[model samples]
Target chain A: MPDWQELVRQRLSGLALDPSEKEEVHVELAAHLEESYEALLKENVPEQAAVSAALFQVTDWQDLQRRICAAKKRGHIMKKRLHQLWIPGFLTMGLSIVFLVTLQKLGFNARIVSWRDSDIFFYAPWLVSLPFLGALGAYISSRAGGSRGTALLASIFPALALTLTFLLMFPIDMIIEPIIGRQADFKIVAAALLKDGIGWMLFPGVALLAGGLLAHVLLSLRPSSRETAIG
Target chain B: MIGSGIKRGTAELAVLSVLHDGPLHGYELARRIEQQTNGALRFTLAALYPMLYRMEQQRWIRGTWETSANGRRRRCYRLTPAGKKKLTPLQREWAELFHALQRLTKVSHA
Candidate 1:
């Protein structure tokens, strides 16, 4: 009676569903709410109270949206997973790697400057766009109902991958160097590689994490009732 | 008041038992359940609808949009063959649970 359809449609604005399917849901739910509201009114409840009571029948619209999506898109969930989770994840990682590779191709070398009695790798050039890219990825992941851990992981995948590379591949590289007749000092080479790994892990990683944190701040309104309450 | 955890366990059975009689829209189904249970099994719209959608998706129930006698459109849900088949086992399970609780706590079901 009170434009329940419009009210429902507004409440469920970001439901990731097709128009027709969503419209069907909207109509069905609106009708149910209207009926309940009318019934409450028949019981001599005030109009505003009846409206509130009917609205309170669905305390968590976001959960309803997700459950409906899960039920309706059971088969399509894998595709949706690819859309919501993997797409953003890969885009962030891909962009980070591409930018780093581009810097290498462009002959941009990192300078090691001593700071606070420790040699530090200065790579401010390639790190310029990383925060923005990371933020975009995190924002997309958040919009897709990803939690802080998943969103952080998606945004910082580049740094994590580099960390893994350093942890695993560096050891293998160290082992293979001797067989290749490169008589580099093991202690010195290990130290340098460790420093390099820490550098890559620290600066770019922090920038990306900063981006993820930024997304969290900017997306303060992001967590639906489902996310905060259920989770 | 029943805990939500317990209510969730019987939600499907409650819905199926109600629909066993005949087709009803979402609102009618919810109201009938609350009334029949003497308001002990009140279901929120958030709880009822997603389960309804899931049941429909599983081919246990079918929903058809129809015009009511009052000329208002309603989506009425009727039990499918699958739904009818499922009800017996669910009823048996609830019966077994009640019997077990009775044996344990000397509490009889109404």
Candidate 2:
């Protein structure tokens, strides 16, 4: 019988492949031959005959290529779907936290407190925190593969942020100018938020924003890997 | 003569079936296919590696690096669990097609 390796080399010499990939094929094909040889041996074939018989059972390269392509295409589609869902929720919450924390750090004590019918400072940070909730909702919807959903989410987040800010500011007006009974002192509200610890409320909003942006980048870049795979 | 398009797929099924038993390097795999076909089917190395690489991507098979008898390092492949599952349906389909083709030709009354 021909040297098995020589026989293999002669057969495969036609298909040109990258060196590393070629090596991979070589090992796999060898294992295939060994198993077939064993089976032939069991059938009482002579040693030479069994080895040669095992070689006869092999398939061609073109057929294997088609199967691999189909499989890769399927894997690509699955990964794309996953990218669509994961981007939005992660970003919205991240941004929200950052916004809140940053505001707090700036010593902006924008909160409203009434003592038996009296206004206090404007707690702007607390009000701003409310808008981020809507933003989070929009982000989540957007990432879930709905263009309309993402647009709706993107549009509503700003509205929620603004509405919360507006609603909270109402008490600020009450503090500045007494509408009814004794008005709250706006200075006290400002002082309270600026009191070192209260400044940290901005941390959450900033943190949320950072996380949101990170998710967005990851999703956007998801397709880039295809280039390398194709290469 | 088999159509070029169908021939490739048929060859892959045949090759995968052989590998289903175990791993084999490139040259061995090609020779075995030719031997099995009784000289009907010939496998060329030029086409083998690319197909093997593609199969590796599909997760139907996995390749591991090993040294050959000649002390040359090469990567070898074996059927994965996923590949094992795929073989049954593929084999069924192949048999169905083969029988259908034979019936169309009306060669024998076996």
Candidate 3:
């Protein structure tokens, strides 16, 4: 008839488990102790002896607390990673598709191999959006406990997807033939692909870097007011 | 009574073997483990719950809260296919270890 729940809560107070998880552990332990106490009582054990026997179960409460907290922390990290990285990464990919379709509607051809001024203008919007997309990714990653490297990697996902798609769809010969026709040799086509690929990627890559660095800097600069106060 | 070290080492297999019978709540699982082991192996809430949570996380066992006839809600743990798959290998390993120990010590089977 001891307040087993309160006892459990007090024992678990130092653990880093969130409120709900702590409550769950509290309830489960209380239930277990209650059962143990009842079983002892059924055998005509004295109340004090039953309580002592029940309490004896957890020989090392400190070790138990550490283990439970560590397990919960790992689970939290996995869930946070999925939410932070993949969700935004996929959303960005969806938005990129919409942006590409809009560009096509505006009479901007995506398949042009030439580095004409018009071609540059056509690709400019996609390139311009990359920094913002990267910023979004980095911001989310930072919020989810990701390091600067993780943020940078997350920011680069959309660009990586685009690059992979282009390479998969059009080989150098196929790409160059459409732009320069038969006048372009394999070497010229290869050179153009390399040059244009880098050209298209350069701004976006910088944007990703800038966004990741900016997120990291901003996060590091901000005071961890809550943790500080708690500590 | 078995040493805590030995008890803890076999805790997972013990729980899995008991749960192979059917789903049981934490209290029932602990009670059955003690009863079946003839009080040699006993699990405290501190020791058992963490292992249960770890096994649940590993997808070996699944826990679900169910209301008893008395309207008390308790989390019951059941063996998953994954847990069942693990039991045979674990049993074999323990058997091998016991045989080796018996051979080395010249001890008869208890």
Q: Which candidate wins on TM-score? A: 3
Q: Report the C-alpha displacement of residue A69, candidate 1, in angstroms.
A: 1.1
Sliding window of 10 residues with minimal summed lDDT for model 3 chain A: A222-231
Candidate 3: regions farther than 4 A off: A90-122, A135-153, A159-200, A208-231, B1-5, B104-110
Give the per-residue lDDT of model 3 (tens digit) for A1-231: 899889888887887777777888788888888888999999999999999999898888888898887766666767766866776666656665677678769887654445655343226666666667677777677666666666677777777775665555447657767787575465564455545765556556676667666666666677772222121
Error of 1 at B99 (Å): 0.4
User: Which residue ranges in model 1 land beyond 4 Å of their true spot?
Assistant: A75-231, B107-110
Per-prediction fnat values? 0.68, 0.08, 0.53
Q: Give the TM-score of candidate 2.
A: 0.42
The sequence of per-residue lDDT tens digits that candidate 2 reaches over residues A167-230 is 5655775666766466565545544443422223343334334434444444456685322222
- What is the TM-score ranking, best to worst? 3, 1, 2
Prediction RMSDs, each to the true structure = 10.8, 15.6, 7.3
- TM-score of model 3, chain A? 0.65
Worst 10 residues of 1 chain B by lDDT: B101-110
TM-score of chain A of each: 0.54, 0.30, 0.65
lDDT of 3 by residue, B3-105 (tens): 7787778998999999999999999998899899898987778878888888887778998878889876688899999999999999899889888987978
DockQ-better candidate, 1 vs 2: 1
Model 3 docking tier (incorrect/acceptable/medium/high)? acceptable
Q: What is the C-alpha local distance difference test score of each model?
A: 0.82, 0.57, 0.75
Q: Mind giving the per-residue lDDT tens digits that candidate 2 earns over B1-110?
A: 55667868887787789898889766667777778878666765435655666676777878677886876665667889988988899999999998998897886664
